[model samples]
Target: MAENSSSTPPGTPPEDSRPRPQYGELAPEGWSWTPTPDERTLATPDAPVSSAAPVAAPHPRGTAPRWDRPVTLSLLVLGLLSTLFAVSMLAMITDSIQLIYTQLDLGGYEPDPSVPGLVTAGIVSVCLVWLATAAGAILLLARGRRAFYVPLIGAVLFVVVFIAFSSAVLATDPTLLNDPNLMDVYGSL
Candidate 1:
């Protein structure tokens, strides 16, 4: 058997890093021990130990968080403005429909009868802008996610859809494309 390297001088006991037995009682050879954990948790026969990670901690709540306060205020303004913008676009679509039908009587110009589809498309575009602005505002305030691009995207979509519809309408009559009245009303000539 290998000799105990920590063997003390003759007639003295060997030293051990672990705690000694009570009352100087002897421990068996090769004895080992593990200390209790720093945290003590009670377990019952029905409880199973789980090694899964703990759920995420919730964010702190307050009446008005610093970032949320300004965002909410800005969202309210944006919501109102977006609604007005949508209404204006709707008015424009109605005006165009009226103009096309009335122009049909102007010296046999015969404006295309397919204006309802264009009107529907225009309305959808306007609604998309309003809906997007509302949804973005709500989501930003609720989740604190970045949604500043929502307004820009909605505006661009409305513009693109309107331009396409307008060009298609005017294309049916090239003479109307150069009409001063259209230029004055659309201001996009």
Candidate 2:
């Protein structure tokens, strides 16, 4: 059997006779068919689509794409720097603790029974906690997750620790504030 060129398949019209939408016309309600680039090219008689058209790789569900932009790069860098800084602060804290003990043992220096040891312990504990927080932030960035919130939390913790320690020191001995060296550091006695 031979098919007639003039006869179209049921529900389909000849290509040239199909209605063309005007520039600002609204599409029909309930079903709007927007052709993809490949489909458009295939439909055009003169423009045959090549078999080598590029296909985008499908992403795995539940995971967001890792951005290669400057903002993400800078965030990773900041996380690394924060981790390094925390490590350095931890080292400094250890040194401060050692120096305090050394002075008491070798320099014949006597601090108040409970205050100096308590202050030293507090400083060491705060540094260790901050170090852990910074490490966690770095890990989150490495895993392609948002990480700056961790460091922000650490900063707020630092503020609280500073205020607590400063108040404690002042309560123990307000005379330290009267010293000219400390006054220069603090801007007021």
Candidate with the greatest lDDT versus the true structure? 1
lDDT of each prediction vs. the true structure? Answer: 0.59, 0.56
Clashing pairs in 2: none
Candidate 1 lDDT score at position 98: 53
Worst 10 residues of 1 by lDDT: 38-47
How displaced is residue 121 in candidate 1, in Å?
Answer: 1.6
TM-score of 1: 0.44
Q: How many residue pairs clash in each candidate?
A: 0, 0
TM-score of every model versus the real structure: 0.44, 0.40
Question: Which regions of candidate 1 deviate over 4 angstroms?
Answer: 1-83, 86-110, 178-189
- Give the per-residue lDDT of model 2 (tens digit) for 19-71: 67654365666756778999898877885566997766665653335452334
Model 2, position 112: C-alpha lDDT score: 45
